[model samples]
Target: MDIHDHNRRAWDRAAAAGERWSAPVSPEVIAAARRGDWAIRLTPDRDVPREWFGDLAGARVLGLASGGGQQCPVLAAAGARVVSFDASEGQLARDREVAEREGLELELVRGDMADLGVFEDGGFDLVWHPVSNVFAPDVLPVWRECQRVLRPGGRLLAGFMSPAYYLFDFERAMATGECVAIHPAPYSDLHSLDAAAREKLVAAGELLEYGHSLEDQIGGQLRAGFRLEAFFDDHWSGGPEALDALMPTSHATLARKPEAAT
Candidate 1:
């Protein structure tokens, strides 16, 4: 089966069920954004620093694989020309629902993150991607696509799962038992995990995920024509505080596409 298609349907169902990531932002949040007092998250808990977004007025922003009605509406309200692209129809529908209710004008496109063919090269001033590339099997292609879509000197603010997040046995960790390392870094249910674990995910209709190394997560951007500017590690607050204190589970990066030779 095609991984992207399978994941797309899974996210569609997830959005229908009102999964946390699928929930739309409130009108009050939109109002706050319009007043220039808004923040968005690439990870749970902490808001992305506002300075990363220098100015939003008339900026062309692309929400890369970041849909479900949350960030896009705020960007629109903040005076950006926003385009929200996602792989799931249902997620895009949630963004559309918000746009209608909030009276925001933003375009919604559904496609693979690795191939942003619908967008012209150098068309976007910023590519705002949250922690979604874990759903893609190969991340380099996605980074390359982000570089291609962004105008020279444009910024890409992205969040992703840290490779270490997948090392622990999830069930054991959830049970408050000792968190044992059952898998290595660069994990994947489709290829790296045992057949039983893979079958479990398949049966549950859960989205398949890949654990990308820092090399691919960070180095990939460098290779894709992006210059790393800022980075931060973040913990998953929903989990046990001890686990969060032990180490960060996710990270966000700010990168810039180099301007054309003078």
Candidate 2:
């Protein structure tokens, strides 16, 4: 099965079903952003730090694989020339709706994040990627594509799930009232789940997901030509499982492409 195509349809279904991520930002939010008051999420319930972003005024930014009208609209309102790229048509429509409603100028593109050939090399000054790479089967290619599309001295701000987040059996944890490590780290929807569980997950319109190691997430960025600048951690509410109470479930990083050698 084509994992990317499966995920695209699944997210479209989610968007149609009114998932929170599918909802567009309100006009009031755009107005506030235009007035220089704005923030966006890199992880659940946590806004990315203002310091992590470069100056947005007149910046050329790409909301990498980020659709659903959330971050790109805010960035556009904040004065960036923003382009939002995503795989799901429904998600892209949310961005377009927000742009038209708020009179924000944003370009929406549809494609896989791992293959950014639609955009030229060195096309963007900044790439803002949120917590969606877990949908990808392999993450190194995503990092490399992000590196390829960024200009010299460009910055990348990315949020991703911690590998440990996939270790727990969420259902078991809820039933037992303890975080039970039923799966090993570095899990994949394709390889980790038995046929029955995998079939059930797919039937529910849930995207297949994978847990990439920190080495592939962080070190892979370095390998793709980024200099790691800053990093932070975040946790989900303990609503799903007890894991969040013990450790962070998410991480974000700021990395920069170096200038050409003198």
Candidate 3:
């Protein structure tokens, strides 16, 4: 399966349906951000610490898979030269909508997160990635590409589902409020789900998610030459899953590319 193409269509449908993550931000949010009262999330509820961004004034930021018109517009309002990149046209359109609505400058690009070939090496000071990468089948390439696009000392602020979140039968847990361990880490909807279930998902236009292991999600950043800086755990806000109430199902990380050797 062409996961990129499939997920793009699914996300486009989700955007059209006004899914939570696909919805655009309000003008008030943009206005506030312009006044330097801006906050963006790498996870569900916890705002990414402002210090993680240093000073946004004139920072070159790539909103990698962050094209829901949420973070990119805020970053632009906060004085960053922002590029909103994603695979889904519907998702990118949300950012474009807000950009037009607020007269904010944002470069919108549609592309896979794992292959950031459109961007030049060391082009961005920060890559703001949220939880969308769960749609990608592999995450190591995503980390490597993020590392490749960031300049020395550039930061990567990312959020992802913990591998543990994939171990459960989420559908069952949501329906019965019981955490039933069924799958392993590094799970794939394509391979993990039964044929009938996969067909139902495809028919419903839902996202095909992947559960990457910590080795690929976090350790991959270290393997790609980024020095881990800060980490935090977060939970889904008002989530339906049983585990959402028991423990954190998501995580955020701050990493920085090493300074250039003299």
**Backbone collision count in every prediction?**
0, 0, 0
lDDT of 1 by residue, 1-262 (tens): 6899989999999999998999999989999988988899998777999989878899999998998989999899999999999999999999999999989998999999999999899999999999999999999999999999999999999999889888888777778756678887788878777889889898888999999999999999999989999999888988755557778999999999999999
Candidate 2 error regions (>4 Å): 238-241
CA deviation > 4 Å runs, candidate 1: 240-242
Colliding pairs, model 1: none
Q: Report every candidate's CA lDDT.
A: 0.91, 0.90, 0.91
User: Which residue window of length 10 is worst by lDDT in model 1?
Assistant: 237-246
The number of clashing residue pairs in model 2 is 0
Clashing pairs in 2: none
TM for candidate 2 is 0.97
**TM-score of each model, paired residue for residue:** 0.97, 0.97, 0.97
Tens-digit lDDT track for model 2 on 16-46?
A: 8778889888888999999999989888868
Compared to the true structure, candidate 3 yields what TM-score?
A: 0.97
**Model 3, stretches more than 4 Å misplaced?**
none
